[model samples]
Target chain A: MSEPRNVKNLKDRINRIEDILASVAAGDMDARIETEIEDDLSGIEAAIDLLIDDLTDELRQREKMQKELETKLKEIQEQQRTIVQQQEDLLELSSPVSKVWDNILILPVIGTLDSQRTQIMMENLLQKIVDTGCTISILDITGVPTVDTQVANHLLKTVTSARLLGAECIISGISPAIAQTIVHLGIDLSTIRTKATLQDAMIYAMKQNKRSDEMKVLSRNALSDEKED
Target chain B: MLELAPDRNFELLGEYAIETEYDIVMARQTVRQFAKKAGMGIVDQTRITTAVSELFRNMYNYAGGGKVLIERGDVESHDALIITCIDHGPGIENLELAMSDGYTSGMGMGYGLPGTKRLVDRFEIQSKINEGTTVRIMKWK
Candidate 1:
């Protein structure tokens, strides 16, 4: 009678361990065996509990790392957006056109000239000409450090384009160094209207503007006189 | 060629691709900086930089693109800068004709090949009709 009772107790303990393992395998992290009796199976039961605890801890750590990676990716995307916005802002700020006087627009170039920037500038200047119907434009290069042959040729093309739009373009701010360099490079600048300083260019444009205004007034007067006759 | 050896400790100053007009300007600026770093005077710096600009323009306009390599070495107790321009363009059929003064091929604006030779201390150019062209210029400091 005592032997049968011990075997039944061992069977019950083994069945309880199987139930805990099944529940743990089914994603129940809290599943644990309650072993109140100390036996040879007690060591194995403790090891299974420890293994589940370590697994749960490792899963939590992986979840935290995945969340961190998602956050980092979001930050990188935000930075990329910010950089694109800044570049757009720079494009607008790099080349600015302003009407300084009647029928006169000044585009002060402040840095080195690239083809892209030149293209933008050409578009800006031409659009401003059409919008304001300005007849005179000044391209001030006082802050431009270097003017190569390519840049000079591009500027010449811009001037030609402005002429087609009924606007005259004056290139100003040829420094002493630039003048010397230009002469040494053997580039012909006689075809383009270039002034040594912005002041000189402004004065020349103002005078031309006044002369055209006078011509327009004279033409209007002559038409009225003829109509009266 | 014989004077510049590996023992002279030639440090690569820069390597650039001459593809566009803008690159010519950029290379000229960097060349000026390198010339200044090598203790060259302002005038010599300008001279060397201008020469390099011409070479860059040639490479870009003719070959559609090419490579420029700049190296600094000690030669005969003097610091020297060597610039090598390599292009796979339609090589010059006649080097003598190309080197002649004011002999522009297509455009009338170029400063001619001989003009570049006058600005440097040593100049060497080699070209094959269908292969390519290589121009090496050296300036002493």
Candidate 2:
């Protein structure tokens, strides 16, 4: 309830209301009349009406601010989601090649390696090897910058997973920094074959491939020779 | 806001190193699957995931640790993706300054807020001086 304000006349009261409104518009809500008002100045009544209108406007402004805040919040949430989806799409796109040559499958990864990408790479590689009945798998990470514990652990897991699937995973491309990081982390990759580069690993794989091929040729020759004898 | 049945589809549970910054990627993937499974439009899906990743990284790096909650709810005739991230760590003192880009908390590249804002259709941040911070983000399709 507003206090009764003392006023000399209707015109004076109206002037006071106008002054209060000016202050209110300037964001001074404390400006209010406290004096008693005399009867007969419709001007005074008009002043009172102006003060009420100003108060209503202020309330509306506050409501608008509240609405703006809510809108901002909604926007923030949508942005968070887009970031996550983009990352996943990136992961999917990064490791999409699938090919099996003979009994060996090769996955060549080229880029700045991160743990998340490594995980996806490992998962896809292992799954494909198992599905294709591949006996040997090669991972060439020559293009990768370096390996830390996280990436190293992921590689180790890939090897372990391949073993469980009855396939061997050969990791190639040991950059100097990655080798140093691995040594510093005290990670043992002795059980898993680590070649100097992807080409080296491929060469080793080819030798293994040729050795098996020669054995098969010899076995067939021996069988045919025996049949002739 | 879209009302979605609580279907916990891509579940990622693990314990990782404290200094490792890879969980940021995992969090991003989780939200991506959720948005895609919910059949959200590409723009909304992308924007929401980006904003959520920013908040998730903020928790992992600045707040030490936190969890993210995502839900789909509908309010009136609009569909929204609701993401809530809460952390019990040192809160923001100067929120206005923090929200402004280039204010690095020694975390990742300082594009956390401004970049996030660009991705989302709506964003809300509330933080106390010491009690912690809660951010609620929503995106409409």
Candidate 3:
């Protein structure tokens, strides 16, 4: 006895459904049974196609969102780099070192002093001192609002480092408040030369230059006399 | 905390909230201006300003943030500038030890509080272990 034709047709439809599912699972979304027959098998085929469509839509949406997030992160990183560059420019502008006179480099500190500023100021001053071989450098702190212990310590370090380079650092423009504060803080700034005003520092620097010049002349003359002898 | 004597009437001048380093500088400048306006001489003005600046530093260092209150009052027929600092941070465990010269938590010369006291006419400190610390310092003209 042969099997019924309807049962054989049903078996063939189920095998088709398995082949469609395998293709879909293998990442082939286009493998759909576009069945036109009006039966239970057709309904299952339609449901499988709908499920694949929804999954494809969701995946596309997620990919788009991931791209947008990547773009946003890159934008943030770019902004941060710009901000860092601008900050460096500002720092450079804040501590301006100029050769105001012969053998004198003047650095007018015009804002609040912090560790970073101090570090930069020290580097700039030291490098200028080496480049110019200037014996007298004036650090004008007239615009500085305060000189706390921390700032004082930083300034002291700057002065010490400048001295090591054979340059005498004159700290001028000591505000009344700062002077009193420094003294009250019990910080020993006696080692560093300080002045009441920039003009005073200038005068002191000129005198120092003149005296050194005279000493050089005297030494040269003595050397010549020794050579003559 | 050492407080202003209630008997002497005080005039509120200005109040400053010290939360950042810049705020401390502004406070010192403002307090100096206030002291000068209250008929304090240059030396006295500087002394008061320095004291307040030190107090602000202490507050910023230990308390994270604090408030500075400036008041003017008459003492012995002269002008007195009163400054009060209040902070809500870890309080000092030992007031007497903190007041001692060269006795620090071993940071340095330990002159933070003692040196400030020397710069002012009257100094008072009040603290609670977990509560906070309040310091009052006055300079008379």
Predicted model with the maximum TM-score: 1
Error of 2 at A220 (Å): 1.8
**Residues A1-229, candidate 1, lDDT per residue (tens digit)?**
2232222377777887788889988989898775655679878878888988998888889999999999999999999999989977877788899999999999999877766788998999999999999989999988876665556666888899999999989999987766665666666778889899999999999999899999999999999999999
Q: Write the per-residue lDDT of candidate 2 for residues A38-74, one digit (tens) a residue.
A: 4556555556667767787878899999999999999
**Candidate 1 has which clashing residue pairs, if any?**
none
Instruction: Tell me the lDDT of model 1 at A61.
Output: 97
User: Candidate 1: misplaced stretches above 4 Å?
Assistant: A1-74, A214-229, B1-9, B16-29, B39-67, B74-80, B87-133, B138-141
Clashes of each: 0, 47, 0
The full ranking of all candidates by DockQ, starting with the best, is 3, 1, 2
Q: Residue B43 in candidate 2 has what lDDT? A: 49
Task: Specify the highest-lDDT model's number.
Answer: 3
What TM-score quantifies how close candidate 2 is to the native fold? 0.48
- Computed on C-alphas against the true complex, the DockQ of each candidate is 0.21, 0.02, 0.25
Error of 1 at B75 (Å): 5.9
Better of 1 and 2 by lDDT: 1
Best by DockQ: 3
